[model samples]
Target: MDSQEDLKRCPVDFDHESRTHASNWPTEFRELRGKCPVAWTEKHGGYWVATRYQDVVAMAQDDATFSSFKTFDPHSGEVTGGITIPATPIPRGLPVESDRPDWNMFRTYLNRRFAPKAAEARRAKVRKYADSLLNRVIETGEIDLVNEFTGPVPAMTTMELMGLPLEEWREFADPLHEMVFTPKEAPEYPHVIAGVQWIFKRCIETFHQRKTEPLGDDLLSYFAHEKIDGRAVTEEEMLSFCNNIITGGVDTTTALTTHALVYLNEHPEDYRRLQEEPKLLPVAREEFVRFFTPIHGLARNVSRDVEMDGAKMEKGDRVYLAWSAANRDPEVFTDPETVDIARFPNRHIAFGAGMHRCIGSFMARVMFEEMMHVVMVRIPDYRTHPDRARRYTSVGTINGWVDMPTSFTPGPKIETGLVL
Candidate 1:
């Protein structure tokens, strides 16, 4: 029904796998939105890009139409792609990749654990971890925030929450960090996949242990003990659930903290404001989430014929909800480019909307606030060398910094009673 000119006008050569393109994506997204809000891309087996805030939100809200299932073998016609743009080689995790009833079952059980109040209750633990990390670097006068602090805080916290071995934090965190950033052609790709496989094996062992002897209030125990449809959870479901929690819990927050530190270091005034007016940190956190949109956007598969913004999308087509672009939509936020630390009514979708919204959002917010507070107070005048920093490529998965070299005046170590 469409002519060559129509197709040419609608097609935008947007590739998330390209680092150069990812780096300057906001500009491209802006241009695309102005010309074609829902442009079709020939890249990655061809998919739709929803650039505007309204369009993205609408697609996200209608999960029935825009399914999260990943179709790996296009020839096989087997429908099973999760949120990732090019379906991840690994199995799709529970709740996130699943439709209702199953999704509702998982959420109902885990919701109480990640509620704001429960996350708040763990503030002391988070502070202890932050202080311990800062203590190691305060005397050195210089540090790599990504390797030393931001990466570890959430990884360690998630390990603690899951009752995973704290000693294995590096084992757990390394792959997640590398997988999201490294390209498939890079030498690190295979190693990262191996590391992820290692995690899967570890999760399976833990699941079995928890099933036999339920332990503390950790997620492992909950998942092991929780009954679904009056029967014990299967090994596959446990692996899927644990995988989702571990992967989701670590990398996203790490990327967020890294980005926030970089931004605040560039704009010292905002950093000072955070220190002087700690109350504003909550609102500022939301703004940072908006500005960074760390994970970028997630993908959804069209289950049925749908038309959006004058374009018709047929069933089996994949559409990407550009959260990062939507966050900067002029229609949604006035001067969306500018970072207003105290932006009120900041309804950002850094956390995906609808049934698949991030379960660890409350934990993310609490940890981010405390981490910022600690950094602002301890290393007030820290300076970052962007030239020395390494940013992630193929930001289709997560837009984050790899190495952030920072220096500040050496300060006395705090006596927080938290030993490294």
Candidate 2:
């Protein structure tokens, strides 16, 4: 709860790091969207929470005014704040942390690797992995959906794409999942940082190895060989690039799928409907992305004074663009709260907007669709244990499940030799 003076300054002062807040942020966001769309808070060294659809889009589109780069200090020209609010312990690099010209340069090179057309080619692999994951648990009749299926699928996908050792998938996924819940000052924070550092060390080693002996056409190879500004990208830049991809690619789709599963399990009719109407899966995927925004909202550093919807934001201040709130805005989607699997023309900001829109969106779509389609068709009657489910403690970066225990009728495994 905020003090009276804080409430006077901004009607709704939110603490995104609060576990209770994260658990029921949707309810809080709904109230904020109606009461005070552009609210401020003293939490995380003070930041604005933009809850309206229009305000979020306006700020997301204006990267120059609301810069994403946070590590670099405007005062002394030295790297200071980490990427997100309640700032991350380590410094992030291009292009998520970079703005405009620099962002475009890095983004342009990586775009080709994640283009929609390029992602389509990975469909077989996606389905193959989905089936393979289900094969291990199909006969078990009980499993933790998040740990067994949702989490590993994308982890394996991203690792394969990065040319990392597949056996080390948990090493990459566990730390990332833990980092989502671990605050900078928490006891587990040091362990989380250590895990990330280990991943970085592995990525740096891969970058060096790929430089010496180029392997398959993977992302690491792109980083190792691709030259920008007439020169190869530095190791630090390469590490940052890898960090962004790993972080973006892993839990987002997992959380989206996890939430979708939890919802579908709760409403068996919707699950049956999706199972029966396979054609609607594509549209359903969009609805799921909109309804269950995996990464709730991201922070932006205000580069200059700006006014939006009668709210004044000062320069150097941080603003949180509530994507989850914007998605549920009644002004945007019809009956935004209700889950409509058939909802079309969904103009959601789940993937963000402007130059910073998620680059792995295409792959995320492919992975999600394949996984959803397979699960619905195969394990349509899967039951999730809500009592045992574990959700992220903070919505600062991701709204995800740490574990979702589920059980379904035992079934046979399909032999799909689509593995490369």
Instruction: Give the TM-score of each candidate.
Output: 0.94, 0.92
Over the stretch 261-281, how does candidate 1's per-residue lDDT look in tens digits? 888888888878877888998
RMSD of each: 2.4, 3.2
Query: lDDT of each model, Cα atoms only?
Result: 0.83, 0.83
Clashing pairs in 1: 69-81, 70-80, 70-81, 70-82
Worst 10-residue lDDT window, candidate 2: 1-10
Off by over 4 Å in 2: 1-11, 72-83, 183-189, 416-420
> What's the CA error at residue 66 for candidate 2, in Å?
1.0
